[model samples]
Target: MYGLIGKIQVVPGQRDALIAILLDGAREMPGCLSYVVAQDSTDPDAIWVTEVWDRQESHAASLTLPSVQQAMARGKPLIAGFSERCETVPVGGHGLATVP
Candidate 1:
């Protein structure tokens, strides 16, 4: 699986519009299993998106599409800052019980 966790700083009053675009696209993304978008409880302008793709290829393919690119373009103006220091997560590491 492929996943990402980061914060997208959106312009005032434009968060809703940006999220709508991302969520809509995620649903249609070729390998997307689930794409979750959330707002920071402390900051309304801070947005977070967690995406899970069936495989690495699907996520990569989505990046080449026009609609997805356009969605990003729409938020370019609203973005005040971006936490882009994300990395590829290890596959199938979920639900491993850790000893407390």
Candidate 2:
């Protein structure tokens, strides 16, 4: 399985809006196993996004999806910067289906 974890810093008061866009875009991801958007406990303007997909290609393809593209465009203005990003290989977890 493929996964991504990232931290995005948004304009001081725009986290909620950005999160809403992300969640809305995530709803129809074809191969998505999980997509979580969380607030950072220590940073008022920071959001953490974690996503899991059936394959790396699925994750890559999602970037080209119309809903995702629209969300990115909508969220672009609210974004201050990307602090960090990490790519991961997922095994199995409670909410994720087992994979070889």
Candidate 3:
């Protein structure tokens, strides 16, 4: 499985709005196993997004999806910058279905 964990820095006071945009695009994604958006405990303007997909290609393809594209357009202005990003290989975990 493929995974991505990233930290996004939002414009001051715009984290919630950004989160809403992110969540809005989280549904109806093919090959998406999980898409989680979390607030950084210590940084009001920082958000964390973790995603799991059936394969690397699926994750890449998701970028071109209309819902994701719209969310990116809507959220662009609220983003300050990206702080960090990590690619991961998922094995097995609760809430993650076994993809055979």
Candidate 4:
């Protein structure tokens, strides 16, 4: 399994709009095991996105998807910057199908 955890900084008061775009794009992703978006507890302009995929290739391929491309286009202007991004080899998790 493959995973990614990242923090994104968005323009002030635009976090909700960006989150909506992200969630919409995530809906139909092939091979996506889990995708979560959360607001940062201490930062109004920061959001956290965590994703799990069946394989690394699936993650890479998702980037070329139309839905993802649209989301990127819609969300790009709202983004201020990226703070942290980490890649991981997922083993198992409570809600992840990989937990078998």
Best by lDDT: 3
Candidate 2 lDDT over residue span 1-100, tens digit each: 8999999999999999999999998767878888899999999999999988999998888899999999999999999999999999988787863332
Question: Which residue pairs clash within candidate 2?
Answer: none
State TM-scores per candidate. 0.77, 0.93, 0.94, 0.94
True-vs-predicted CA distance for residue 40, candidate 4, Å: 0.4
CA lDDT, candidate 4, residue 69: 94
In candidate 3 the C-alpha lDDT for residue 73 amounts to 96
> Between 3 and 4, whose lDDT is larger?
3
- RMSD versus native structure for model 2: 2.4
* Cand. 4 TM to true fold: 0.94
Per-residue CA lDDT of candidate 3, range 11-94, in tens? 999999999999998778888998899999999999999989999998898899999999999999999999999999988888
Candidate 4 per-residue C-alpha lDDT over 1-100 given as tens digits, one digit per residue, 9 for 90 to 100 = 8999999999999999999999998877888888999999999999999999999988899999999999999999999999999998988868874321
The stretch of ten residues in a row with the least summed lDDT in candidate 2 is 91-100
lDDT of 1: 0.73
Query: Candidate 1 deviates by what RMSD?
Result: 6.0
Worst 10 residues of 1 by lDDT: 91-100
Clashes of 1: 1
* Residue ranges of candidate 1 with Cα displaced over 4 Å: 88-100
